[model samples]
Target: MILKTIFLGLEAGGKSIVIMNGDDAERLGVLSLGRVAIRFNGEEKTAIVHKSSKLADPGTIGVCKRVWSDLGLSEGAEVVVEAASFPDSLYFIRNKLAGRKLGSDEMREIVEDTVAEKLSDVELSAFVTALHSFGLDLDEATYLSLAMIETGRTMKLDGGPIVDKHSIGGVPGDKTTLLVVPLVAAAGLLIPKSSSRAITSPAGTADRAEVLMPVTLDLDEMRGVVERTGGAVVWGGAVHLAPADDIFVKVEYPLSIDPLLLPSIMSKKRAVGADLLVVDIPTGRGAKVKTIGEADLLAKDFMEIGSRLGITVRCAVTYGEEPIGSAIGPALEAREALEALMNMGTAPDLVDKATAIAGMILEMAGRSDGKVLAEELLRSGRAVEKMREIIAAQGGDPDITPDDIVVGEERLTIESGRPGHVLWINNSSVAEVAKAAGCPKDRGAGILLHKKIGEVVGEGEPLFTIVAERTSNLRRAQERLEKARILAVGDRMEMLIHEVKERPVVKRSFNLDR
Candidate 1:
């Protein structure tokens, strides 16, 4: 049947959708959540159908933003509407739902439909949930990676060794990439780094880097920056590298599962033509991987996938018991990272972790004195210079300094009640407190630690300070802090952690940062 287009001027989060009148829908034999084939001007596209009796007239169809843009529909253009069949990928998804492993062709079709926006949110959620329920093997992971790479934009720079780094993030205040990018770039290597924004953590690498410079550079701009300065820190979502991973991320976030962790990380690396890669797994009781053994297992999987993708991969299992540095928000962490790069302050752990990872990349690329060289570059101010170059190339202020980065003005200092050595720090609690203070959004809102693990604290001395852009947010963070044991200062470790009185609803914390 032919119908007139009634523009809805709405976006369904990149999904193609159209609203049909209830009578027209009945004649077409399509349900409210069914599919429709919209054809106009010899061009056709599939859209999800939403039946409405009042919203749309009987002889007209309401076109959403995605479908409207795709078909170039005008206010009263004529279009052909017909009942559409479900995609074949749905069958494959059902097979996976039944706990059967999918083949390469099946995985490819599902991922293609995902990229093409042919699958609705419900279907996509079912696919991700099935993967989470019945974990995918390495073969399935490789297929997913290849399909994701094929569907998205890729960067191909003519270079000898294209190196990159990624952190399986869980720990808060990890500004390591801020140092690693400049440090590695200073050593003269092409590093087109694409990072993600915060999903679960207080801040992601892109969130922190955005404080220092613009991270939404397109592929051309990213390549230009890397070509000129040997490195760049851009947001992955902007580059469209492994865009299917972005759609999958949306499904995984609500479900609190990340079964595609391997493909999600490796596919982007492969898309960027990376020759060498380093994956950082922060391992500890408070981290995503709660133990060293688990970290190693994750590392093995990464290496195996890397090998299959023709990229040399190494894993760095670092200490994750606490926040990486004293800062736990975007602006504050950026300031801390800048200070470490300039050697103006003592963030030994941050410096150590950055240099160690940079060193690994260097050593993997055939440098024996990797750590030493990394340290030298940082100590000699070369890393800072290189960082400035990168900032200038990426359209940020090259003269940006630690003092120039503004943090939240409103501050609350948490004091130590008794004198002792700091025993432990809860990474999750730190993230929670930081988030309460209007974290990534506020940019300046965060926490600054006065002491770390094993540091001696005097009675009534300040333990940490929480900063916020607004008074209300500061109060909110204060409330969360009251219920959280963020830091423990004691002469000896406590044997009993917590007593369970009865059965409790366990809210499993899943770290979804990539």
Candidate 2:
């Protein structure tokens, strides 16, 4: 317990070493050299671990084996120690840490402290991997959500019926946020929307919004924008709300593990002071939730969790077997979303879905006839006006047109091979192709869908077009699209079936004793 000196080196077997005093070693239950612990003197502290090399001075104490043993290690154990405390960062680890399973409370504390800059990245990664492996149950997820909320900034708006919409994201070119926010806002509702940048898509809502005006705004600026326009689209990362979720996403992205953090996802909206919420769960062969059952379960979880968190959650299970809109990149999708708002775009599916979703938000926000209100807003140009106000508030010219937004000069058209019905357009393929085309970064890079599924196409008609700032990216996009066969056409329409075949049961058993 007394003040002690610190020494660092390696042990005989090449394990890191730390040196401490005899009294400390005895108190720590170390009987032999080569142990691990910490020593503090005044304001300085150092780690003591087993060192492979010999000590230069006899005065330097060797770490005791009993202390190492007490510190917890199995046979053939090795330990590495560092002087710095774990910084508050999410850690990506390949193996599990040696410890008892974390309880809900402990996990919440870890996540909160980590986000608050109390834990190091390595420790955070360790904790993340632990959670990922053993998995967080509903209770744990709920606690984690609360912890995330406690650690970050929360917006407290005095307005009622503030609605927000979110998509689990997998399908590309789903720029519904652009239309939905304005439509709902124009219906005399509050929707201070915040979206993320592209993680795996050619463009994210935030990325697309950036095409027209700045999406990143500070807390005060965001609130002002929302108060002035009744709605504003901005990037969530610019705010510190649910900061841990952002860190978790960075780690979760490469792992491709859907933590399915329903509470965490909803908490951000709750944190933003949203009372009404619409969640879009895109389910299809190529989407994140591949099965209808999976999407349903996720939707239920989101709704249940949202209810518990004091938010009304309405889930929309939408079609994502293909891309949602005619545009599959940042600039293209931005252009398309703007045109759809102005009722100038031809992508009826995109407009329809956006209007439907926005209508739901409107209904929840007290619009008696949500669909009609939403349509009137769009057709009468109120939604477009709201969007213009939002754009102007976010530091952009309100009068900017879709054509005024310059795209990449490099473009390539995919012509129909033969006259037939367009059978399918794979969402994953479109996402990959657009990404290859340098979408979110290039702003001008993305794909424009000219022919949608079930549409009749002539041999000379264009199926889609790829645009990019670079010719190499255009070629890459073309190559990826060609490999995936995104635009499939045939004389006959392909029908998907769910059939069950039963086999006759054979009754036979062998006697093991015999």
Candidate 3:
């Protein structure tokens, strides 16, 4: 039946949902809560059906953003929705859940179905849970990666040895891509750094980069930007590479489990045509890998997967005991990244970590002294210049300065309770506080570190500052801080260390040696 599309500004997370008037549902023989095959612009998708009396007239169908987008229907545009059936691949997902080892063909079929959104959130979650329960072997992981790559778009740089970096992620405020990309680009390497939005943290590399420039670019635009400036920092999601990754990610967000890590990571890198890749594995307390042993095992898996795909992969097991830097929001992180690139940021840890990661990538690309080269590029202003060129190429102001970036107007400074040395900064607490302040989404909201572990703090000295776009958000962050032990201080905290110290140990305890 043809029905007018009415917008419903709600996130129908993991499923397309359409709302209809009770009279329409009763008259059209459509029941509320039943599946409907919605069609518009020669495209069709199954969305969960909802019925409302006051929401719409009898002839109209209410669509949330996902449905309207998936069907390509304009507001008030006519749509045809009918009863739909389950997809053929749904049985394969069930088989996986039954402890069956799926072959490459089966995996590819499932991935194809996933990318096409044939699987419901329930089906998708079932697949993720099956993998999470039974787990995927290296061979299976490789197949999944290949399948993910095949299911979406692929890009190839004009030349050889295009490099890329990825973090296992659990640490917050990780904006190294901003520094690493520019530094590597200055070294004349093609580093098309495609990052994600804030999956969990206050800010992701792409989110931070977006604060300076646009991150969403098509292949041609991204290639043009990279060709002009040795590198480009953009959102991988925007290019729609390995689309299954995001589908799983959306389900995993609520499930709180990371299934199919190998395929999910490798597929994105492979889709981007990364020949030389660096995987940053932050292993410590409150991190994805709680032990160095686990990190090593995961690192081995990454390298082996890379070998299967014919890519050179190096895994850098960095410290993830805390957030990467002092700034844990988009605009704030972008500002801090620039400051560090210019060698003017007080957050030495942020600068040092970026240099370390970039150096490793450089070393993998045949440079013996990667750190030295990275530092030189950063210090000599070449890295920043390349970054500015990239920013300009992506339609941002290349001449924009760090100070020109404005963070949230509302601010709150958290101070030490007593005179002591800094002991630790809880990664989870820091992330929570920043989230409370409205980071990633609220680009201007975040937390800034004034002191890190082992730093001396006088009574009432500021520990960190939180900035929020609105007073309510600032207050919300303050309320969250009251329960979180973000910055620990003790008369004897941890021993005082040099300002150049690069400790990645998180605030919590871990079993790394074992």
Once fitted onto the true fold, the runs of candidate 3 whose alpha carbons sit more than 4 angstroms away are: 1-84, 493-514
Predicted candidate 1 versus true structure: per-residue lDDT over 1-514, tens digit per residue: 9999999988878789899999999999998778999999999999889888787999999999999998999999999999999999999999999999999999999999888888889999999999999998999999999999999999999876999999989999999999999999999888889999999888999999998899999999999999999999999999999989999999999989999999999999999999999999999988889899999999999999999999999999999988888999999999999999999866899999999999999999998899999999999999999999999999999999888999999999999999999999988889899999998899999999999999999999999999999999999999999887799999899999899999988877678988
Query: Each prediction's Cα lDDT score?
Result: 0.93, 0.72, 0.84
Least lDDT summed over 10 consecutive residues: which range in candidate 3? 505-514
lDDT of 2 by residue, 1-514 (tens): 3322322223322222355445444555543332333432212223333222244222334443433333443332333322343322222222225434445566566666555434434454566677667776666667677778887888876676778999888788888899998888787788988888887677888888999999889878998998899888888889878887876765555555646357557768888899999998888877777788998888887887787788999989999888877888887888888899889966788888888898888788776777777888899999999999999999988998989888889999989889999987777677778878887799998888888888999888999888899999988887887666676877886575334478746422110000
Residue 466 accuracy (lDDT) in model 1: 96
Q: Spell out the clash pairs found in candidate 3.
A: 321-506
Candidate 3 overall Cα lDDT vs. reference? 0.84
What candidate 1 gets wrong by more than 4 Å, as runs, is none
Better model by lDDT: candidate 1 vs candidate 3:
1
As a whole number from 0 to 100, the lDDT of residue 472 in candidate 1 is 100
What TM-score should be assigned to candidate 3? 0.87
Candidate 1 lDDT score at position 285: 80
Clash pairs (backbone) in predicted model 1: none
Index of the highest-lDDT prediction: 1
* Global fold similarity of model 2 (TM-score): 0.78
